[model samples]
Target chain A: MARRSEHTREQLRDLMLEAAEQLIVDKGLAGLSARAIARQIGYTPGTIYLVFANLDELILHVNARTLDRLRVPMQAAVAATDDPEQQLLGAARAYADFARSHPNLWRACFEHRLPEDVAGPDFIDARIAQLVELIMAPLARVSGAEGAALDAAAQSLWSGVHGVCILTLTGKLHMVGGQATEHLTDDLVTHYLAGLVMRAAPADAR
Target chain B: MARRSEHTREQLRDLMLEAAEQLIVDKGLAGLSARAIARQIGYTPGTIYLVFANLDELILHVNARTLDRLRVPMQAAVAATDDPEQQLLGAARAYADFARSHPNLWRACFEHRLPEDVAGPDFIDARIAQLVELIMAPLARVSGAEGAALDAAAQSLWSGVHGVCILTLTGKLHMVGGQATEHLTDDLVTHYLAGLVMRAAPADAR
Candidate 1:
C-alpha cells in the first residue's frame, strides 16, 4: 500500500511551512524557489504549488509563524505583569528575546514582503498588526494619543525593539561588552514609552 | 596616441572611488562588483586592480572614502557646539545624519565582515574608533560615572545608536507615521544618555 499522503494534512502543512522557513534561514528569500522547496521535502513542485500560491505567499505563511513566536511571548509577558508600564516594557523585552532566539525568522517577518494576493496593503495577515495593536492598545488608552501620533509611536516602538534585536543578532555588538543588548533594549523601551506617557506635560517635542 | 593615462594617478583614483560610491548609492553593495563598476565607467577591471588589489582591498579603499563621509560631519558638529550635553547630542545627531545621507556606504562599512588578515583580535581602526571616542569623551569627563559602570553606560549608548541606525536602514520604520524615524532616534539618543547621566544621581531608581 503506497502512501501518497502518508503524513496527515495538518502534519503535511507544518512540514511545508517548516521547509519554507528553513529555506529562508539557509538562503534568503531571493534564493527561495518552488523547486528548491520541493527538493527539501521530497515533493514535486506541483505539490508545493498545492501547498503555497508561490514563493511570496510561502514566505508570508512562514512569517506568520515568526510573528506568532513574538506574539505568544509578549502575551505571556503582559499577563505576568499587572502594571501597564511594566507590561509594556515586558512586551518589549519579550520582543528582544524572540528576536535573539530566532534571528533569521524574525528578519523574514519584518524584511519579507508578501505577494499582493496574499498580503494586500496591510500584511500576509492581521497577525503582526494584531501584535502591534496589543502593544499599543494600553499606551493608547493611557496617553490619549489617537490616530497618527499613536500610530507613529507604535511604529517607533516596533523600530525600537527591532533596532536592538537586529544589532544583537549580529556579532558586531559583542565588542560593546556584557548584556549590552538587554540593557540598551530596556533603556529604549522605558524611555520611549515614558515619552509617550509624557502627554501630561506636553511641550514642543512634537 | 590616445592621451596616455589621461587622468593623473590621484584623478583616476578619485574617479574610480566616485564611481564605486555612485554604484553603492544607486544599488546596494551586492551590485557593486568589480565588473559592474568597470562597465559603468568604461574602464577595464584591470584598471581598478591597478588602483587597488583584490575585492577586499577595494572595500578598504572605499572605506577610506566611507570613513571620510562618517568623520567630516562629526567633526563639523563637534565644532559647532560648546555645551557638553548639547555637544554630545549634536554628535549623536551627526552620526544618524551620516547614515541617512549615505545609506549604501554606511551599509558597506558596517555590514561587510573584514577578512581575518585585517580584523585581528584587539584590533581597532582609527576612523570609526575616533568618532566613537569623540562621542563618549564627554562622559569620560563627567566625574560622577566611575570605572566599569561608566564603561557599561557608554557601551549602551553606542549600542542604542547603532541599533537605531540599522532599524532605519531596512525600511522597517516605514509604517509608522508623523516624523517617526527622526523623532524616535532622537528620543532613544536623549533618553539613553539621560539614563547614563542619571546613574550617579539615581538613588531611588534602583
Candidate 2:
C-alpha cells in the first residue's frame, strides 16, 4: 500500500475502485466516503477526487462494475437453455442468487442515487438494457409480444422479479406472510408468463 | 411552541411524530434524529426518548401511520367495484398514486431498517397484513386461488407493483427503458392474474 509512485492514472483508478468496492462490501453505502476509500488504499483524499469527477461519479463507477458482474450469471442462464420458460426462470433465479450472495453490493447499486444536478450516466442505462434483454428475448418467444407491448412486458416482469428479491432481502416479504423467496419468484415468473401467453393472440384464445 | 408540561405522554408522542413526519417530508430520512424532532416540537431529546425506546422505534411508529394512511385509498378502491380485475387494478393504482404523492413517506416505510438488536414491531406486520388483504381478496376471486398458492400469488403481485413504484421514483425504471410506470403495473397485474387463472384449474385448460 505504498504511494502512487509506480502506478499510471488507469492503474491508480483501478486500485481506487477496488479499495472502494471492498469498503462498500465491508460497511455498506452509508459509511462510504472518498476519504474512507483513500485511507483504505494509502492515498490522499485529493487523489481520489483527481481520478473521479466527484463522489457520485465514483459511486456510479462502482455500480457499473456490480452490473457487469451481474451479467455473467444472467448470460449463462440464458445460454444454458433453448426453452424460453426455463431460460427466463434461470435468469430470475440467477438474479435472486446474486442479490442474496452479495446483498451489500447489490443494495448499493440501487441505493446510491446521483445528485439532482448530475444526469444519470449512460453506462448504467446500457447495463440495465442488457439485463432487461435477457428477459425480453424469452418473453417475446413466450408471448409473441413485440414493440411497446413487448418492452412494457419485459420491464414489468423484470420489476416483479426484482421486487421479489428486494422485498426478500429487506425482510419485507416476511411481514405479509413468509413464503419462501424462491417459490414466490417461481410463482411470479410462471404465472406472469402464462398470463402473457393467453393475452398474446386474441384469435388463438377465442 | 410551548414546552411539554401541558401535555400527557401520549399527546406528547403524537406531537413528536407530527414534527418528525414534517421533517422527513422536507429532508428525507437522512436528517431525522431525536434532537431534530425535539427541537421542532419544543422538547428536549430526553423527553422524546421518554415516549419512544429509540430512534428506530419512533421510525417504526411513523411507518405504521403511513401504512394506515395508505389503506384509505386501497379500501375505497376495493369497495368501488365488484369485478375482480377492476378491484385489483384500482388497488394497484391507489398504491402507485400514494407512492407518487408521498414519495418520501412511502420510501421511508420501506427504507427504514431497524437495528439488529431491535425486532420489528407487531403493529407494522399487522398493518402490512391488512394492506395485503386488499390484493388477496380480489386475487382469490380472480384466479379461484386458495391457501398457500393464494398467499404466494398475492405477495408476488404486490411486490411487482411495489417494485414499479420504487424503481420509477428512484429513476431506475428509466434506465431499463422508460415505459410508463402505470403501464408496467397494469401489465404485471393483468398478465399475472391471467397466468394464475390458467394455472389454478389445469384440469379446465386441458
Candidate 3:
C-alpha cells in the first residue's frame, strides 16, 4: 500500500504538524506553507487545508508545540533548585539556552503574526500563562510580592531576560558592547531580584 | 510629461523610500516590496533597482532613518534630566513612546532581517551604538560602573527595557499579566536600578 492510504485524520494531523515544524526549524516562517508542508508529507495542499483551517491555524499549532517544548527545560530548571535566587537564574539560563538551541522555532513563537481578522486560539495564551506562572512561583518566593505586584515583577523580569536572548540571537548584543548573552541574562535576573528584595525590605533596614 | 520625469535619481530614491515607509506603516513588512513602492511613486520597478541594489539595502536605509529619528527624543530625554535615575527612566519611556507611536517603523528596525548572504551595512551598527551609549551614560552615573563592567550594565538594562517593549507590543505582556505596559516598564527600571544600588553598597551598609 502507498503511504497516503495508511493513516486516519488524527495521524495525518500529527504528520502534517511534524512536517510544518521541521520546515520552520530548517527555514524559519518564510519556508512554511500548506504547499510546502504537503510536499514534505506526500499530500496535496488541499489535504492540508482539510486538516488545518488555514495557515494561521497551522502556525499557532506549531507555536503551541514550541511553547510546550520550552516549558520542559524551564520547569526542570525551577525544579532543580530550592533557593529562590538560584531558581530564577536557572530559569533565565534555561530560557536563553532554549532560544539559542532552537533559534528558528523559538523565533517563530514570537515572530509569526496573525492577520487582523483572525483570532488566535486561546490555548496559545494559556501555554504562555503557564510558563509565566512557573517563573512567578520562584519570583514570588524571592520578592515576597503577591497579586498584581507579583505579576508585574515576574513579567518585567522575564521580559528583561527574554530581551537579552533576543538581542543576542539577532546579533544586536554586540552592537552595544559584546557582552555574553548568558552573562546579560544572569545580570538581569540577579539585579532585578536584588532590587525586588530591597524594595520589599523595611525602610529602616536600608 | 510623466510624473516619473519630475525627479533626479536622489529625489526618486527619497520618493520611493517614503512610499515604502508608508506601506509599512499601513500594512507592516508584509506590504513592502520594490514593486509596491514603485507603484506608489508612479515609477516602474526597474527604477527602484536603478537607485538601490536590492530591497534589503533599501530596508537598511529605512531602518537607519528610523534610528536617527529615534535618537532625537532619547538624547533630549537624557539631556532633560540631571538625575541618572530619571535620565534612564526618561530615555526608556521615550523609547516606549516612540515604539508605540511609530510601531511599524520601530518594528521594521528589528523585525526586517537581511538575507543570509548579505552583509548588513556598518552604519546600522553605528546608529545602534549611539542609542546604547545614550543609555550607558545614565547607567554609568547611577551604578558607578566603568569600562567593560559599565558596558555590560548598560547593555543588560537596556535589553531588559527593550524586552518589555517588545513583549508589551506583541501582547505577550498581557498574556503574562494585565499590568499596563508603561507601568511594567516603570517597575523594571526602578527595580533594576535598586538592585544595582544595593550591589554597589558597602558590605556592612547593605
Candidate 4:
C-alpha cells in the first residue's frame, strides 16, 4: 500500500511540473505562481507546498529541466564532430538553436533571480559544470591550455557565445544588419579559436 | 510665457524618470510602473502619461538615461589608453564595471522586451550603434580588416565581452570558482584579438 502511494506521489509531482512548464512557456516566469500551478493541475494551492518548498524551488526545478533539455543537443553536437573546431562550432550552434527555439525556457534559466541570501541548489551548479565540461573538451584541444587555463578558456568562450545568443534573442543584434545568428556564431567560434591557437603558437612562429 | 511652461514640463519629465530609476534600483523592472513613478514624484498617475506616451515609453527613456551614463565610462576608457589592445581591454573592463555598479539600470537596458509588433525607437538603435562605434575604432586598428570584416569583428568581440558581463553579474560565474570577471574579460579580449590578428596574417607569414 505504501509503495502504491509513493508512486502516486511521484506521478503527482511530475504532473505539477508539466503544468508549471506549460505555464512558463505561455506566460514567462512572471506569470508563474503556486496558485496558477495548482489550478492548471486541478489541485488545491496547498498541494503545491506539499510537493515543493516554495515557488522559488519550483522555478529552480523548471530551470533544471530546461538545462537537461539543453544538454542533450549540446552533447549530440559535440559527438557529431571529431574536429575540435567543428565540435566547438556545433556546440555553439546547438546552444543558439536551443535558445531560438525555446526563448522563454532558455530565458527562464538565466532570468530567474534567486533571493539575495540564497545560493542555488548544489544540483543546479553540478548541471552547469556538466555543460561547461562539454565545451572544455574542444577548448582543451584548441588552446592546449591545461588545468586552470583550460577552465578559464572554456568559461570565457562559452560566455562569449552566450552573450551573442542573449543579444540575438532580445533583438539587440538587429542593429548589426544581415548577420544571422548562425553566421555570428560561426564567426565568433572561428575567430576565437584562431586566437587561442595563435596564443598557443610558438613565439618564433610569428 | 511658453518657454517657462516648457521648462517646467522638462523638469517634470526628469523628475519622473529619476523616480522610475530609483524604483528599478530598489526593486527591478517588475517594480517599475507609472503608478510607482507618480507616487515617488508626488504627482497623479495622469501626469506620467502627460510627459511620456505610455509605460513603455517611460521605460525606454529610463533605459536611454542608463545608456547615456554607460557611454561616459566607455568613452573615458577608450581615451585613457592609446594602445588599441589596451583601449579594447579598458572599454570591456569599463562595461563590466558599469553593469556591476548599476546592475538594475544596466539590466533594464536588456531585460525590457518591446512588443513584437512594435519597433524600437530610432534613437535607441542609434545609441547602440554609438556603443559599437567605440569598439570599432580600436578593432579597426588591431585587425586592419576593413568594411564588413571590421564590422563583424567588432560585433562578435563585443558580444563575447558582454556575455562575460552577464554571467558574472547574474552569479553564474560563481559556479566556475574564483575567477574574477576582470580576468575573464581580459582573457576573452586577449585571446579573441590574437585570433583576429592571426586570421589577418599573410599566408607567407605562416
In candidate 3, list every pair of residues with a backbone clash: none
Q: Which DockQ-derived CAPRI band holds candidate 1?
A: acceptable
Stretches of candidate 2 exceeding 4 Å from the true structure? A1-6, A175-179, B1-6, B175-179
Task: Give per-residue CA lDDT, model 2, range B46-110, as digits (tens).
Answer: 99778998888888889999999999999999999999999999999899889888988998898
Model 3 residue B70 CA deviation in Å = 1.1
For every model shown, what is its TM-score relative to the native structure?
0.73, 0.94, 0.96, 0.94
Prediction 3 TM-score vs. true: 0.96
The residue ranges of model 4 lying beyond 4 angstroms of the native Cα positions read A1-7, A175-179, B1-7, B175-179
The complex in candidate 3 yields a DockQ of 0.82
lDDT of 3 by residue, A41-69 (tens): 88888988788888888889989999999
Give the Å shift of residue B203 in candidate 2.
2.5
State iRMS for model 3.
0.8
Question: What DockQ results do all the predictions give, each relative to the true complex?
Answer: 0.24, 0.77, 0.82, 0.72
lDDT of 1: 0.66
Candidate 4 lDDT over residue span A1-206, tens digit each: 12223436778789778989999898888789998987777777887788899988988998999999999999999999799999999999999999888988899999999988898898788888899899998888877878877888888888998988888888887543324677777888888888888788788875
Candidate 1 global TM-score: 0.73
Q: Model 1: runs farther than 4 Å from truth?
A: A1-16, A27-35, A42-57, A111-121, A124-128, A137-158, A174-178, A190-206, B1-17, B41-57, B60-64, B113-126, B139-146, B174-178, B202-206
User: What is candidate 2's lDDT per residue for A158-183, written digit by digit as tens?
Assistant: 88888888888777766332346678
Q: Which candidate, 2 or 3, would have the higher DockQ against the true structure?
A: 3
Write the residue-wise lDDT of candidate 1 on B1-206 in tens digits: 14337877677677777788888887767667888777766777778788777666666667667877787877777678776667666776777778877877887776555543555122325665566667666766542565655555455555566556766555445553224546766666554555455445566742
lDDT of 4 at B49: 82
Better structure of 2 and 3 per TM-score: 3
